[model samples]
Target chain A: MDKVIKGKVWKFGDDIDTDLITPGKWLGSPELKDHVLETEDPDFPKQVQKGDVIVAGKNFGCGSSRETAPEALLQMGIVATFCESYARIYYRNSIGLGLPPLIVPGVSKEIEKGDEIEFSFETFKLKNLRTGKELQAERIPDFLLEILEGGGQEKILKKKLKQKLKELRAKKE
Target chain B: MVRPMTIAEKILARAAGKEEVKPGEYLIAKIDLLMAHIAAARIVARFMGFPAKVRKVFDPEKVVVLEDHFVPAPTVFAANAQKMIREWAFKQNLKYFYDIKAGICHQILPEKGHVRPGMLIVGTDSHTTTYGAYNAAGTGIGDTDGTVAAALGELWFKVPETIRFVLDGKLPKYVMSKDIILKIAGDYKADVACYKSIEFVGKAAEDMSIASRATLSNFSMELGAKFAFTPPDNKIIDFLKGRTEKPVTSDDLVKPDEKAEIEKIYELDVSDLEPQVACPHTVDNVKPVSELKDVEIQQAFIGSCTNGRLEDLKIAAEILKGHKVHKKTRLLIIPASQEIYKAAIKEGIIETLIDSEAIICNPNCGPCFGAHMGMLAPKENCISASNRNFKGRMGSEDAGIYLASPAVVAASAITGVITDPRTL
Candidate 1:
């Protein structure tokens, strides 16, 4: 598993709902990638490069549990989100989809918009390359890390079923 | 060690196949019931990609699929999604399929006697918590999470702390359960119950009707709660009496442990409270009904799982009887289920509402979703009985949405703007 992620920070405030991330109207759109985060920041989909990180204040992903919220970020080449807190469903969806939402302590206030951030999943630390300050985030939960290693819950189920079938075939033989 | 367990923790512990559980602990619990609206089910069925249909599931008897979101297929996508799920449910031999003739999933589940105390129910929509009114340990889930829970019959949860909301007094006339929840959401702030369960107790909760209880649990999401419940009171038992084959006594209900560590406690006196409304842009931006008394509104909507019930419809019908909706305003009434629709019709409540020039529609989440029908035009203002009042919630981002009770929404529809229901 990749433990280190370095990216340019994109800032947002509290309650960054799924509607703003990817509105309901654009749920099945092939052009969703272009409109991703368009409601929040018009330039986001255009300017966001391959390793951009979203750092938002408390209660991030606050409304409506749409998987498209994280899908929008992932498809736009945004890799990670650092929030003070997260709504339960959105948090579960993010880790289950392989896009990790790390709960960093006050990283939103400490880091400037567009600052270079180096995140270490193992150490639970974020280094501000521009400001030369280090901030600590909560250690990734063990269950979530395990899920990530298994390529998320979907893969885990596939592997579990496959193993079960193999065991049954071997026993029958 | 499990020191003490609330009704929620106990149900979770039992479902997790453990003797006990505590707050903040994560466990994979067995799901007793799995439900999804047609739109959400379609998304879940196709979540694995490649234009798939979820033709087989673990237990067909345990799964429920409801065609409530877009009943007759408003959009092409909705039509396709509903058709695919209907076909898939049939293939899976799903036990409960409330086709378009039925209404909202939350309302129909209880009305059909599927919900029971001590059960662990999971649904694709955010208002699944509404089942908590039956004393079931229920919580809303996202599409992907719901799909997994439905297929595998299990889902992971981080046990939440409890917030005890003690409703100490009798609710005065015109102050419905909707008002109490709004007061809690507005006064106490959204995070008060965030990641926690709010266990309702005291006289008010005990006296509230089943439909009214539904409203409280339905809006629990506004508090950011993981779960919210009032132990299945006598009202719920009585409602289920003949509808259910099994004997349901008060003893079947569960309660929170007296010794359990509650994160916080709040006492609300319903008798002293007035009508409340959540203003534009947020459910938590609540104010007294008088605050916006003069603000003109173009429409008043009484529907959604939050308010579309016989009890709520009666409240509107009573106010609109022998009177007309304001010429400047149009009143839209939606019964939550075909069951609610029939009940209102039998009682002549629907006729009275129609006589008042109120347009009635079948049970579905209409304007609440800003889809199909009832889209607000630019700069339009509406007073709605639905849950969320978030900006662009009903349509154009420029439109304003205000949340209130059915009685308040109806009274306001008569004169336009926000009017206190007490005056009428």
Candidate 2:
């Protein structure tokens, strides 16, 4: 995982729930990425570029336990998310999918929609490149950080499963 | 000496193999049950992506897979997904697998005796908190987390601080557990209990039936609660009798210590509570049914994991008996599970609903999350007993959804508008 991340911001308002991220109607569709956030902003999927970040108001991911929400954002090339706060399940899903959803108080007011921001996971600081304002984000716990550093839960689980299988094979000899 | 511990703390401590646990402490805990529904397809995909040739679930007996989300296969996409999940379940040789016949996952867990006190349960659906009604620690997780837990039978958690809600006084007529939870949401807002466990206690809570308690815990997710519990009483003990496959021991029951640390205590009197409704776009935008009298609805749905139990159907039937649904509005009644469906039929609740012109659907999630059966059109409004009312939840983004209790939904269906059940 990168210690430092820099990206352009796409701003959203409070209570931007999972439905707005990926609607229920498109649950099992293959082209789900094309409809990502289409309910909130139809142009988001078309206009969003790789390595961009999302900055939003309070309770950014507030509905459903769909990992599809964060998965869609990752597919759209969103590097990370900065919100005032997040619903617990969404925060977990985001971290599990290797998308860092950092809680930075007053992030919506400090950064503009198109502003270029640089964030450091090492220092837990976010700096607005345009205005030169810096904000500190809440530190993620060490256990979750370890998972994030290992490329999310999938990679970590795979490694553990491999070790288990190897041990089982040796035992059978 | 060991410090006092809340019910959530006690459950987590046991799962984590610790003598005691405090809020904000992170630890990996053994899971008693791991559940998945149609989204099991996603979990299976992720689990199969691993390079290990001998991949296997940690415990097949503890894993439950249900086909509830897109039951009966509404579309080709849904059909393929269900097929994938079915094949995977067979391949894994899981012990508890329910096909489309089984109702919603949340309702089936407790109804079938899969849930018990002091257990730590996790599912892929957000309403997994419904299991908390059994005095267990239940919370929802994403597909990847579910996959990991299925493989390892354990997951990490940050022990949540507990919020205590003490409800006293008797509930007035037409008001139910749904109203109490809606009132709490209106008063405290959605994120007030974010990442926290809520313990419901006091006279009113103790008097509620197991079904009513399920409503309280099931809807706790709407308030951002990590877990919600209505302490086990004799009522729960009776409900668990003969229903569980495993024996229930005295060690399974747990309670909060008298001196346990609670983040906050809210005492509410429910003597004068009214039917509450959560308006479109957000669950926290709540109002009494009386205040929404002028809002007309095109459909009134009474079903979901939130309030699709037999108790909810009886309430709806009582109001709909001998009355015809308004010509302008369509009424959709869905029992949460096949067990509830058969019971309702035996109790004549289904006949009463059908006589009132209500379309009784199968035991599945019917149009609750807009997956199938009864989707709303553009500019249409619906009064649903379901949990969520977020934008585009039922169908089109232009359609509106108002969430209320079964009585309120039934009354609204008869009037073709959001009507108070007491008024009817």
Best by lDDT: 2
Q: For residues B1-424, what per-residue lDDT tens digits would candidate 2 score against the true structure? A: 7889988999999999999989999999999999999778888888777765656788989999998877788788888888888898899899999979789999888878998999999999999888888888899999999999998899999999999899999999889999999999999999978999999999999989889999999999988999999976667667887889876666678888999999999999999998899998899999987777589999999999999999999999999998999999999999999999999999999999999999999999899988688988999999999999998899899999999999999999999989999888
Per-model TM values vs. the true structure: 0.95, 0.98
lDDT of 2 by residue, A54-164 (tens): 999998888899888999999899999999999999999999989999999999999978899999998999999999999999999888898889999988888888887
Would you list the clashing residue pairs of candidate 2? none
lDDT of each residue in B1-424, candidate 1, tens digit only: 5678887898898899998888889899999898788545544464444213232466988888888876678778777887788777787788888778789888888888888888898887777888889998777776667666766789888888888888978887888999999999899866667788878888898888888988999898777887789856687788787766586788878777778778788998887888999997878889989777598999999999899999999989988888899999999999998888999999999999999999999889888876566878889999999987765667777889999999999999998878998897
Alpha-carbon local distance difference test for all models: 0.82, 0.91
Q: List the residue pairs that clash in candidate 1.
A: none
TM-score of 2: 0.98
Error of 2 at B240 (Å): 1.0
| Highest TM-score against the true fold, candidate | 2
For candidate 2, the clash count comes to 0
Winner by DockQ:
2
